[model samples]
Target: MKVLLLGSGGREHALAWKLAQSPRLTTLFALPGNPGIARYARCLEGIPLTDHDAIVTVCGAEDIDLVVVGPEAPLVDGIADRLTAEGIPVFGPKQVAAQLEGSKLFTKELCKAHNIPTAAFGRFAEPAGARAFIEAQGAPIVLKADGLMAGKGVIVAMTLDEALAAVDEVFAMGVPGTEILIEEFLEGEEVSFFCLVDGETVLPFGSAQDHKRAFDGDQGPNTGGMGAYSPAPVFTPEIERRTLAEIVKPTARALADAEAEFRGVLFAGLMITSAGPKLIEYNVRFGDPECQVLLRRLDGDLLALLEATANGRLAGHDVTFRDDAALAIVMATRGYPGDYGKGSVIAGLDEADAVEGVTVFHAGTRLIGDRLTAHGGRVLNITALGTDVREARARAYEAVSLIDWPEGFCRTDIAWRALKL
Candidate 1:
C-alpha cells in the first residue's frame, strides 16, 4: 500500500520508520519531511500543506492509498475532512473532532456536558475577568490559552503572582488570542494514554510519560516535549484497567454521544492522584517524543492497524505490543522554546545509531548538501527499546553521549521516576 505521511517532526519520522517495516507497504512518502525520515520514505518538498487542492493533486499523482497526518495543526485545519471528501483514506479526526485539541474551552465544556472526569475550569475572554477568577481560585491554579499555542499554552502556576502573570503573558503577548482558561490544578503524576478509535471501537495503544520541563529535575519552562519513555511504570496493568474503565471509555462514549464519533488517535493527558485518573486535557493527534518511543516498541504491522481504524473495523483488528520498554531523549537546539540559532552542523549520528537498540529520529533538522544541521526548537529524538526502563534509558543515553552537537541539548534523566522503580 502506498502511504503519504504528513508533518516534519520526530513523530512523523517514527511513524515513517514503523510504517516502512510493514510488508504490506509498497511505497512511502513524507511531505516536507526532515533528513532523518528521508532514510525510510521519499521526502517531498514545496507541497503547501494548507492548500487542499495541492495536497489532493499530490495524492492523486503519487497514487497514495492512505494519508496519515502527524501534527495537530493541519488536522485542526480540516486536512482530514478535505481528504475524506475526495474519497482518500486519511488516518485522523475531522476538523469538528479536532476542536478537542484546538480549543481548551470547547473540551472543558464537552467534558462538563458529558460528565467526564476533569479539572474544573472557567473560560475568560477578558483579562479583567480572568484576573478576578485567578484571585478567587488562589495559588497553584492552571492557566491556559483557549486556543492552541504549540504545547506552551498552559501554565501550572504555583503562586497567585505566577497565575496573574501567565494571564497577562498569554493575552498581552497576542499569540493565544483573546480567550484563556483558568482551571483548578489537579495533583498527580501525569501520563499520556493513546487509543485508536474508529467511531465505536477503541483500541488501546501503549502509554508514556512525557517530560515537559526543558531541564533536568523537572525545573524549567514547558516545551513540546524534552524526553519520554513508554510502558510508563506509573500506568501499571491495574491502573490501565481502571483508567480505561473510568476515564478512556467514558471519554470515547461521551464523544460518540456528542456525535463526534472521534476517529484516529485520541490522546488523553491524565493525572493519576489520590482521586484516581482525571483528564488533564485531550489531544486529537499523537504526542511527539512519546510517539517516537511508543512507535519504537510497536511490534505489529502499523499500516494494517491504521487501515483498520480508518475503515472503522478496529474491533476486528488485533493490535499487539511488545513487553519491552522504550525511551526517547530529545536533543534540542540550545535555548529552545524561545530564541535559538539554527543551521549549526550536527555530527556523530552514525556513532549514536551504532549502539544496539537505538534509533535516532529527526525532528527539526535539515540536510545541507552532506551536512545535517538544526532547523527547529527540538531537533533529534534518540529512542531505544529494552527489556526494562533502566536498560532503555541506558541505551538511549549511550547514544546521546556519542552525538557530537554542541549547539544542541537534551534532558539527561528522561524517565527517572519510572526507571528508579
Candidate 2:
C-alpha cells in the first residue's frame, strides 16, 4: 500500500523508518520530510501540510492509500477531517476529538464533568479572575495556556510568586495564551501511557517516560522532549491496570459521551501520586522522542495496526510489543527551546547507527550538499533496544557519543531514573 506521512520531525522520521520495515508496504512517501527520513521514503517537498486541497490533489496524483499525521498541529487544524471528507483514509483524530490536546480548558472541563481523575483546575479568560483564583489556591500551582505551545504551555510553579508570574506571562504577556488554566500541582512521579482507541474500544500500548525539561536532573525550561525511554519501570502491571480502568478507559468513554468519538493515538501524561494516578494532560498524537523509543521496540506491522484503528476495527486487533526495553536520547542544538544557531555540520551518523541495536532518527536536521546540519530545537533521537534498561541506556549513549556535532548536545542521563532504581 502507498502511504503519505505528515510532519517533518524525528517522530515522523522514526515512523517512516518503522513503516518502511513493513513487508506490507509497497511505497511510502513523506511530505516535506527531514534528511533522516529521506533515506527511507520519497520526500515530497513544497507541499504545505495545512493545505487540504493541495494535499488532496497529491493524494489523488500519488494514489496514496493511507495518510498518517505525525504532529498535533495538523490534527488540531482538522486535516484528518478534511482528508476523510474526501474519501481518504487518515490515521488521526478529528478536530472535535482533538480538543483533548488543542485546548487545556476544554479538557479540564470535560474531566470535571465526567469525573475523570485529574488535578483540580480553574479556567480563566481574564487576568484579574486568574489572579484571584491563584491567590485563593496559593503557591505551587500549575499554570497552563489554553492553546498549544509546542509542549511548553504548562508551567509547574514551586512558589506563589512564580505561579502568579506564570499566569501573567501566559495571560498579560500575550504569548499565545488568551486563556489559561491554573491547576493544583500534584506531587508524584510521571509516566506517559498511550492507547489506540476506536471510539468504542481501546488498546493500550506500552508506557514511556519523557524528559520534558531541557537539561539533565529535571532542570531548565521544558522543550518538546529532551529524551525518552520505553517500558517505564514506574508503570508496573498493577499501575497499568488502574491507569487503564480509571484514567484511559474513562477518558475515552468520556470523549464519546461528549459526542466526540475519538479515534487515533490517545496519549495520557499521568502522575502517580500517593493518592492515586491523576491526569497531567492528554496528547492527540504520538510523543516525539517517546515515539522514537516506542517505535524502536514495536515488533508488528505498524501499517496494519494504524489501519485497524482508522477503520474502527481495533477490537479485532491486538498490538504486541517486544519485551526488550528501549531508550532514546535526544541531541539538540546548544541553545534549544530558546534562541540557538543553526547550520552547524553534523558527523558520525553511520558510526552512531553502527552501534548494535542503536538507531539514530533525525529531527531538526537537513542535508546541505553532502553534510547534515542542525536546523531545529531537538535535532536527533538516538534510540537503542536491549534486554534491559541499563543496557539500552548504555547502547543509546554509546551511539550518541560517536556523533561529532559540536553545536549539538544531549543529556548524559537520559534514563537516569530507571537506571537509579
Candidate 3:
C-alpha cells in the first residue's frame, strides 16, 4: 500500500520507521519530514500540512492508499474530513471528534455529560471570572487554555500567585472569547493509555509513562516530554480494567452517541489516583516520546493496523506487544521550553544508532549539506529496547553519551519512578 504520513517530529520518524518495516507497504511518503524520517520514506519538503488542496493533489498524483496523520493540528483542522470527502482513506478523526483535544471545554463537557472520570473543572470566558475561580480553588490547581498551545498551555500552579499569573498569561494571547479552564488538581502517578478506535471498536494499543518535566529529578519547566518508558509500572492490570471500563469505553460510547465516531488513536492521559484512573487530558494522536517507545515494543504490523482503523475494520484485529521494555530519552537544544539558539552542528549519530537496540529519531533537525544541525527545541529521541526498564534506560543513555552535540542536553535519570518501584 502507498501511504502519505504527515508531521516532522520524532513521533513521525518513529511511525515512518515502523511503517517502513511492514511487508504490505509498497511505498511510503512524508510531508515536511525530518532527516531521520527521510531515510525510510520519500520526503516531500516545503509542503505545508495546512495546504489541503496541495495534499489532495499529491494524494491523487501518487494514488495514496492511506493518509496517516501523525500530528493533531492537521486532524483538528479537518484534514481527515477533506481526505474522506475525496474518497481517500485517512487514519484520523474529523474536526468534530478531534475537538476532544482541540477544545478542552468540549472534552470537559463530554466527561461531565457522560460521567467519564476526570477532575472537576470550570470554564470561564473572561479573565476576572477565571481569576475568581482560581482564588476560590486555591493553589495546586491546573490552569489550561481552552485551545491548543502545543502541550505547554496547561500550567500546574503550585501557588496562588502562579495560578493567577497563568490566567493572565493565557488571556494575554488576545484570542477573543478564549475560555480558561481551571481544574482541581489531583495527585497521583500519570500514565499514557492509547487505544485504536474505528468509530465502533476500541482496541487496546499499549501503555507508557513519560517524564513531562525538562530536567532531572522532575525539576524544571514542563516540556513536550523528556523521556518515556513502555508498560508503565503503575498501570497494572486492575488499573487498566478500571481505566477502560470507567474512562475509555465510556468516552468511545459517548462520542459515538454524539454521532462523532472517532477513527484513529485516542491517547488518554490518566492520573491513577487513590480512587482510580481519572482523565487528565486527551491527545487525538499518539504522544511523541511515548510513541517512540510504544513503537519499539510493538510486535505486529503497524501499517496493517492503521489501515484497518481507517477502514473501520478494526473490530476483529488485536494488537500484540513484546514483553521486553523500551525507553526513549529526548535530547533537546540547551535551554529548551524557553529561548534557545539553532543551527548547531550535531555529529556522531551513526555511532549512536550503532549501539545495540538503539535508534535516534530526529525531532527538530535539518540536514545541511551532510551536516545534521539543530533546528528546534526538542531535537533527537534516543530510543532503545531491552529486557527491562533499567537496561533500556542504560542503552538509551549510552547512545545519548555517544552523540557529540555540545548544544544538546537530556535528563540523566529517565524511568526513575519505575526504577524506584
Q: Write the per-residue lDDT of candidate 3 for residues 238-356, one digit (tens) a residue.
A: 99899989988898898899899999999999999999999999999999999999999999899999999999999889899999999999999998989999999999999999999
TM-scores of the candidates in the order shown = 0.97, 0.97, 0.98
Tens-place lDDT per residue, model 1, 116-198, is 78899888888899999999989899888766778887788899998888888767543545677889999989999999989
TM-score of 3: 0.98
By TM-score: ranked, best first:
3, 2, 1
Model 2 worst lDDT window (10 residues):
170-179
Best prediction by lDDT:
3
lDDT of 2 by residue, 1-421 (tens): 9999998999999999999988889999999899889988999999888898999999999999999999998999999899999998889999999999988878888888878889998888888898899899898888887777898877888888887777777774334536778899899889999999888889988899999898888899988999989999888899989999988888888878878889899999999999778998999999988998999888899999888888888887877899999999999999888899989999999999999999899899988998889998889999999999999989988998899998898888788888884
- For model 2, the local distance difference test gives 0.89
* TM-score of candidate 1 on Cα atoms, chains taken together: 0.97
> Where does candidate 3 clash, by residue pair?
none
lDDT of 1: 0.88
Candidate 2 regions exceeding 4 Å error are 172-177
**Residue 57: error of model 3 in Å?**
0.4
